[model samples]
Target chain A: MAIPFSYSLRNLWTRRLTTVLTASGMALVVFVFAATLMLAEGLRKTLVETGSYDNVVVIRKSANSEVQSGVDRAQASIIESQPEVARGTDGRLLLAKELVVLINIPKRESNKPANVVIRGISPASLLLRPQVRLSEGRMPRPGSAEVIAGKSIARRFKGGGIGETLRFGMRDWTVVGIFDAGTTGFSSEIWGDVDQLMQAFRRPAYSSVSFKLQDVTAFDQFKKRVEGDPRLTVEAKRETRYYEDQSEAMAKFLRIMGITLTVIFSLGAVIGAMITMYAAVANRVVEIGTLRALGFQKMSILAAFVMESLLLGLLGGVAGLSGASFMQLITISTMNWQTFSELAFSFTLTLDILWKSLLFSVGMGFVGGVLPAFRAARMNIVEALRSS
Target chain B: MGMGNGKPPIVEIAHLSKSYRRGSQTIPVLEDITFDIADGEFLALMGPSGSGKSTLLNLIAGIDKADEGTIRVGGVDITSLSERELAAWRAANVGFIFQFYNLMPVLTAFENVELPLLLTGLSRNERREHVELALQLVGLSDRVDHYPAQLSGGQQQRVAIARAVVSDPAILVADEPTGDLDRVSAGEILQLMDRLVREFDKTIIMVTHDPRAAEKARIIRHLEKGILTDSDGQPASPVAGS
Candidate 1:
């Protein structure tokens, strides 16, 4: 007959100090694992959330990012005139012909220069992306030199605050507004008047054209039409797919790095668990013999010890995940490999991450406990009872 | 061999033998030891240290295997049973008591007694009733919630006895049940074992070196040099008590 479940649980409780010490070691590994996963997830979420599913982004066929794309006025106009393009409330096409470039900026604290994205946009830019909201002051007017900074840029960079003037493009540009783009890539950019920026930089075509589609499902036909058009040398892609592509390289790198670090650290954690379990078996020899004499079979003894280790994993998982959740409040900045710009994002915790981390912890416990549990099960009852 | 009462033996051993190997040296522990324990009998096997008394007890309890014989207990040849089947048989038919009063320190007296019943198909309420009755029989019903450390030596041994009998197994095997106890506590334990045979009709086989412990049993035997010491290889008569 199988031993009762409480037998294992109470045995763990009886060795409270060992349980805490071993669990804490496991908790440290889980914390590293969960935090690394959260970093990758956060970076991916920031970029993927920047795009709308029903919107299509038109860019140069050879360009991988908006900064690398170029659309001349003729090409922009031809793309905007498509019948499948959604119209705005004012009866104008809901299209934005934007120009994107890279500029170096100094941080407020470290004073180290970093590459930042400077985007020149039309009035339809705000109309296309509904996620961006003006948190302070007003949007920059058309045909003016005023620019707006994202909330992240305003908080971290020098001369990025509202009403401050930043010298860029050989001209003094006033930061008139500060906008918040919740957990999206746009929060790492500076936006200004497209015409003024083009004139200031000189000899530049639009970087890309983004527009809302009339029917989301018509994207296949629209992509074929745009790619087939002789007058245009551009490709049409869903904005969601575009942003997802932008997030892919950096997210993959983060996940690989995270997994490597966690794998190395988990070895130590698993070893710690093994030592703890072996010690437990050594200490409970007589108790195990008594149990055997009481007619608990070898399998029951094995299961009881394994259950104790599993409980350790359970406690460790909860502790590690609890620690990772607090990381959501910390915003960190790093270089984005896709666009060669500084991007800021928080460590985000998701339901999938939660479950996977917990399972990983339990897996560590299982691997760590198996050998010791076998030792416990294979013990001779005579010897076990003989040991006081 | 049949006993005088004509009641079939609860534990029957014929030509039983066992040996141990210590790093390439074969040490015989019990050789050609044979006996039969009848129903409702209290028997004791006594010897000095390292005389195989405990090994003999363990063999009859199905905790160890015998090399050269057949042991039929409750009409089944236990010597032929597989390890897994022996485990099941031991759970169903054997109860055990140990010298150190090996109650689980983490479990309360009541919980410790309720342990063996967890293997049975008995419901929770039924198990509780059985555990309560066992504790009551040991006259420690009030100590059910107490931990083993909180109880005295005699009380702890009584708790162990309660745990042993809680499952109502066919036979109870005890190894040095009073070896760690004071004389007063040991006497109390012997009286309790005697009461179990008289009142609950339990069949008990205890291994010890104490003459007072052997006197409590109806039939007593001696072991020496891995063999039974009686010339005819039968149990000697019960010792006259002081």
Candidate 2:
């Protein structure tokens, strides 16, 4: 018969101070691990949700991002007239020929220079991005110098609020409105009329052409037909896929950083667990001897100690995960590695991250307690009884 | 009282020897010791320090192995069993009471007594019944929820005795059971041991230096220089005049 589990539980409870101290150390490491994972997931969710599955974005072949891609006016028209393009309520193709450029801005608090994305959107662009809503003020007028700032941009950068004007590229652009794009990358951008932006910047081409497919399954056939056209020197891709690719580099960097920090911190937690377990073994020599004399086998003693450590890890996992879930209330912004422009997001918690964090904590406890448990099991009953 | 079951001895130890190695030197503890303890007999092993009396009791309890000869307890040659087998055998056969009342400090009197029964296949209710009976036998039934530290020395010893006999083992081995107690506690513990054998018919092998403690046993023997002797301190005489 196996030893009762209460034996291990009561033993740990009896040494409450050391148990709490060791569990807290493990909790710190788990907190770092969980927080980093949440941060990366948040960045990925923001960018991935910025695009739609049924939409196809046409960009210049071999270009890394929309900012670096360009299509002539004729190519944009041809791409918009495709048979697979979905028609809007106005009987026009649901397509937007857009331009993107990066400009330097100074923050209100830090006064430090940061890159902000300035998006020049066609008339159909607002209809295509349903997630973007005008929270305050009005939309920018077409074919005018009136621009609108995203909620994040208005809050962070100078001259980015309604009725403010910013001078750049030898022209004064007035901010006529503020729009909110909930939990998406568009919240970091400033939008204006595409034709006015093109004329002001003296650009003869559009950065990208995005059109919604009539049917989700038609995306493959539409992409092949558009990219197969000899007059078009551009490639087609799903907008969602494109945004996901954009987040790949930053998300990967965050995940690797989280793993590295957690690995380093876990070493300290494991050592703390080992020290606490060793102390328990040392103090309970007589108890172990008494158990052995009561006919408990060596393996029983080993299992009891291991169970104690595992319980400690589980407690730490719960504490750390609770602390990390509170971070969702905090919003953070960083420069998108792919676009080199500001991207705003929040820390997110998911069921997958929760389970993985718990598993990792349990693994640490197993590693820390194995040797001490072995020491406990290998004790000689005759000698151990003599110690006390 | 002349006591023999008119059958094979419950504990038969013959030509048993044991030694310990320290650094490169071999120190002999027990040498060529032989003894027979009858069924339902309460025997006391008396000796000075380093006389190997505790070691002999441990051998009889199956917690230690002999270097030579055999120990046949309850018609089984326990010396031939492996460590795993011996642990199972001891769990079913030997009960241990210690000098310091080796009850688990974290457990209540009831839980401590229930420890051995956990090794059995008894249901939870059945185990509780057994624990209750054991505590009642030791007159500690009212202190069932009391932890070892909360009880007085004598109460603690009674709890230990309850835990030892709770499993209904074939034999009991106590190493200086009252060595750490006051006079009143010690006398009470001795009386409890006497009652265990007299009423429960358990075979007991107790090691102690106290003459008063030995006087409660049906037979008393002495060990000197790793050898067992008869009651008159003579060499190699049969107990119960066998």
Candidate 3:
């Protein structure tokens, strides 16, 4: 016969101090677990959400990221003129030659300059990413000494917000606007006209040319056509896959770090739980004997104690998750290892993370409580009764 | 001789011997002991510390196994039952109480009484009614919501008694039920036990060192050094001979 659930709950409540202490320990473990997942989530979201599935990036052969790749303007033109490229309403192919670089910018808070990503793009860049919208002021005019800062970057660095003037190389450029990229990776960069940025940085070649495809199905044909030609030695990749690859290493590192830390912390927490549960069983020797005498099977006694520990775990899980949710309000700026530049991200605690954390807490409880419960169940009833 | 024409006693013990092994040597705790209890008979087991009164209780309650011999309770050979079967059998037929008033500290008085009923297949409403009736029988209806720590020692023992009889078992085995109480509280508990035997027709077997507690029983058996004797210290007929 099944014991009522209240039996477990009441057992935990009767020893409220031990329950809270063990729960808090488990809460700390869960907090670390959830934080690791969130870090991985942030990294993946930063890269995967930055590009479209239908868009293709043309980079130099053997080049991995845009910062390491360069293609001549002539190559960019040739790629734009390909028949497989999608055409706009104006009867011209939709494409843009872009430049990406990392430059140091002073922070408003600490005045210590940090490396921030700078992107150079033509007018068609905005059309390619329709989600990008100006939030505070006007877009920078083409061929002007003006720039637009992503909302996150503008909030962190000095002279980054609209109407503020910032220096790069040897010339001063004004922050003409503040823009948002609808949660894409571009939301962490500063944008300027491609030609002006190229000239100011003394670079004659474009980093890469990104173009929209007719459809996803046409990708194979386009790839075969481009790679078959002897004249162009470049690689074509779907924009989404390219960005996803960029974030893979960072995400894996975060996941490993998170899991390792959670395991270590859980070991300590489980030991704490074991000690607390053992103490409870030891103190309740007579009670357990009486339970046995009252026709409670040994298995029921085991289950009762295990269930009490699980309840403690659940309480800890809720506390840790709720505490982690508050991290969303603060912005954390860290180096994107792939690009070697700082990117701002927030703690995105989704529903899946919360539930997974709770499950982890429960697993810890089971691991911690089982041995003591077994000992309690195996106790001699007569001896226990005599223990008065 | 066995009781009445060829009907077996409700409880029968034959050559029931139990010993505790200390290293290689066996120290006998209950040696060649035998007895029978008829249906609805109240028997008191009285003994000194080393006399095995509690061991006898433990063996009968299925909490411990005898080293030798057979024990039949309610016409079933309990010594041969598996641990799992014995637990179920105890739930159906045996109720137990202790001197320490071992109520679960977490549950209220009412919930403590309802614990045994959880083993039955009764529905929630039925369980509630039975638990209420048992608490009312113990006169602890007013303390139903109180936890063990909140109740007095006497009240706690009452809750324990309520728990023991809640499932309406065939036998109630109490080990020093009044051992931890004052004279007044002890009297209350004894009076309750007497009422269970007189009015409810429950067969009770109690183990106690207190002669005053044993005087209330219909019959008293004494044990010394694993040997059973009558009140006058005469050798009683072996249960196997009966």
DockQ of all predictions against the true structure, Cα-based: 0.69, 0.73, 0.75
Residue-level lDDT tens digits of model 2 in A1-388: 7777888888889989888889999999999999999999999999999998888889999777888899999999898788888989989878899999899989877989899988899877888889999988898877778999999999999989889997666899999999999989999999999999998888899999998888889988887887788998998889999999999999999999999999999999999999998998999999998888889899998999899889888888888899999999999999898999999999999999999999988878888888899999999888888887
Instruction: Name the 10 consecutive residues with the lowest summed lDDT in model 3 chain B.
Output: B1-10
True contacts kept of 1: 0.68
Return the top candidate by DockQ. 3
Question: What are the per-residue Cα lDDT tens digits for candidate 3 across A1-388?
Answer: 7566897897788778888888999988898899878878877887788889889999889888888889897788778888778878887678889998788989999999998888899767877877788888988888889999999888889999889988995789999999998667788899999899999999989898898887778998888888787878789999999989888988899989999989988999999989988998999899888787777889999998899888888888888887777777766778888888887776677788878999999989989999999999999887888898
A136-210: candidate 1 lDDT, tens digit per residue: 999998888899999999999999999898888899999999999999989999999999999988936999999
Better of 1 and 3 by DockQ: 3
Q: For model 2, what is the alpha-carbon lDDT of residue A333?
A: 92
DockQ measured for candidate 2:
0.73
| Model 1 / residue A30 / CA error / Å | 0.9
- The TM-score, computed over Cα atoms with residue i paired to residue i, of candidate 2 is 0.97
Which window of ten consecutive residues has the lowest lDDT sum in model 3 chain A?
A324-333
TM-score of 1: 0.96
| Order by lDDT, highest first | 2, 1, 3
Q: Candidate 3 at residue A317, lDDT?
A: 87
- Tell me the docking grade of candidate 3: medium
Listed in order, each prediction's TM-score against the native is 0.96, 0.97, 0.96
